[model samples]
Target: MDPIVEVVALILGFVGWVMVGVALPNRYWKVSTVDGSVITTSTIYENLWMSCATDSTGVHNCREFPSLLALNGYIQASRALMIAAILLGTFGLVGSLVGIKCSKAGGENYILKGRIAGTAGVLFILQGLCTMVSVSWYAFNITQDFFDPFYPGTKYEIGEGLYIGWCSSVLAIAGGVCLACSCKAGTKEKYPLRYHDRGTAYSGAAPSRSAAASTYERNAYV
Candidate 1:
């Protein structure tokens, strides 16, 4: 297999993991408010409503007390996974480069290199799948729950940031797969194209009768 391709794929895999490890857990993501007032969890869940205070319209104001620690942990884990992804991506890129270099060298190990590249690509794909699943879950469920505790009452609209995360994961996966393909080392290519012994060409045939006889005589003498 092309060593360069393998290296590149490894690097990409690393990067992919890194990305996944970094940006996953945020429960109360803030968007613009209708009244132009910045609506954030910090603003809403600031004070204690000990007296069950009501507004001018006599509406009981229920302030939210979302758990930040749980969200923080999820986010940290997701971010760590993202970092791993980034590393994987970098590895894949390096592997691809190695594969290209090996191809140019016209070595007998081209098939091996290709096979290696293919393996790396498969790994990259697996990592990407994981990344997608984690990010999707966090964006839809964890983060949504953070914002609105009401079950079946909240619909999460994935923002641009989540989209970017997905895109990066996809890119890393693609690069890794490509590198693996480039470095795949096939069986035939792993072996020599032509079989020869001591500069004598060999055909897929038995030795000539005279040559066999000579070998026998030599053995007999020994």
Candidate 2:
């Protein structure tokens, strides 16, 4: 793998994982009331784990939600998925660091290192998917709630955390893909056209020998 590409991917994955961590604890996934004109009293901001209300006087009151079992399905699922992604991303980061060609921690086995890097790439991809799914699901619910006319509650608008989650997901996926491509390139370099050239040479030799044998037989007959 090219050292530059490996380093770029590693950086992207690390940054993305950090962003995910930052986003998870943030209470900015949605905000109460779509219109800023109705700032009469206070505003509420919510996330997977908690909700916070800011009064007109700038006093902020925050409240954590109930236990996981008591939360709604979407909230529970999002929380679980984000946690899983974080764990997987952490493991993937270790693998990536050890497997990167620029690193000296994984011994001198280049092939093994490449394999480990590829595995890390797969893990990163999975982590990205988990984050994407969680964010998308949460966004869908937010949109649904916002558009529902029958719902009597204040409509919430998408928040900064959702945007951050999206960016993190993209970064994770892109980094994983780059690492995977690097692994493929390394594999190709290891066995560049050796088998194909051997097969072509063998085939060419066989045809020529057969042609010479036929000529000799014809001459013998004549």
Candidate 3:
């Protein structure tokens, strides 16, 4: 196995950590909203009740449970996850490159190397999908839209940034895979040492000076 593939696998592992540990949850919060303002309630020990006054009664009530901030946090986490996924894809490309090189280097068969490379390709494709969704979310403020659906209000969307980030990630992974595979193909050569054994050559051939050695042995004995 090429050292590069190991490095790439580590990088991919990092990406996975970032997504599961940070990003996915953030995005979820970003795209969601918690009911508040119109809903508020004061709680008593061991007891809680919700009451709202209608227009006819002329009484107002509030309930507090859902937090918008928390929902926004989820959105942020989701974006982070998308970024991580893209980063992971980049590593996949690197793995492919390593596999290709190994195949060509004669350490492993081309078929095995190619399979590894193909796995990386699939990861890149998945990353592309994630990037698309992330970019869309950033540009359209999908999170905010999700929260309000119909409300028209000023909000921020980092669509361009998200799209660019995703693109770079995808490119890195794809390029790495291609490079590794090509390297493997180009270096493919089964060395005579490991394959067809030139037994004498490998084991050490009989000395060309054998006749001279015999004469010297006789003289020494005399």
Candidate 4:
């Protein structure tokens, strides 16, 4: 595998994983949108787990949702997805460290290492997908509520947490693609093109037995 590409992908995956962790506990998945209404005395914000409000006085108070069952459907699902994403990232990191070409964790069997790295890549991709779906679903609900004039509830706008999650998802997917490509490239070097189609090594040059013996001896020494 290309060591440079492997390292770059690992960096991307690590950053994305950290971003997801940051986003998960963030208090502002959505914020109350006042539409420039200065008269609006208090602004409210919420995330998957809790709600918070701040008055013009700059004092803010937050409270966890009273019950999980009472929370909105999208919020519950987002919570699950984000947790799953974190778990996937953890496994991917472990697998990546073990499988990376420069690492000694998996020994010198490069073909096996390549497979492990590819699996890690797949895990990272799944992590991105889960995070993407969670944030997008949450944002969709916020917009749907905000656009509904007849809806009696307080309207909210997308917040920093959702933006962070989106960015994390993008980084994760990009990293996974890079890692997968690197692992795929390793297979080419594992076998020479002359023998690739034949699924076996070239027997050697068509020549005298003595020449073949000499070639074999040189190969063995090398």
Model 3 scores what on Cα lDDT?
A: 0.47
Model 4 TM-score is 0.88
Candidate 1's residue-wise lDDT over 1-222, tens digit each?
A: 445655565666666555554433322232222232354332211111111224435555544445545445555565556555556555544544444444453256655556545655765776686567656654665356546656553233444446656865776676567565654443445346544452354332346766889999999999
lDDT of 4 by residue, 1-222 (tens): 998999899889999999999999999899999885769889899999999999989999999999999887888999999999999999998888888899899999988999999899989999999999999999999999888888898889999999999999999988888898999998777667656655432334335666979999999999
Model 3: residues with Cα > 4 Å off, grouped in runs: 1-69, 73-77, 83-87, 101-106, 142-153, 157-159, 169-222
Which of 2 and 4 is the better model by lDDT? 4
**Pairs in clash, predicted candidate 2:** none
**In order, what lDDT does every prediction score?**
0.52, 0.89, 0.47, 0.91
TM-score, one value per model: 0.47, 0.86, 0.38, 0.88
TM-score for candidate 1, residues paired by index: 0.47
Candidates 2 and 3 compared: the better one by lDDT is 2
Worst-scoring 10-residue span by lDDT in model 3: 43-52
Candidate 3 lDDT tens digits, 105-143: 435666666556656655655665565555455545544
Best by lDDT: 4
43-115 per-residue lDDT for model 2 (tens digits): 8999998889998899999998868788889999999999998998999899999998989989989999999
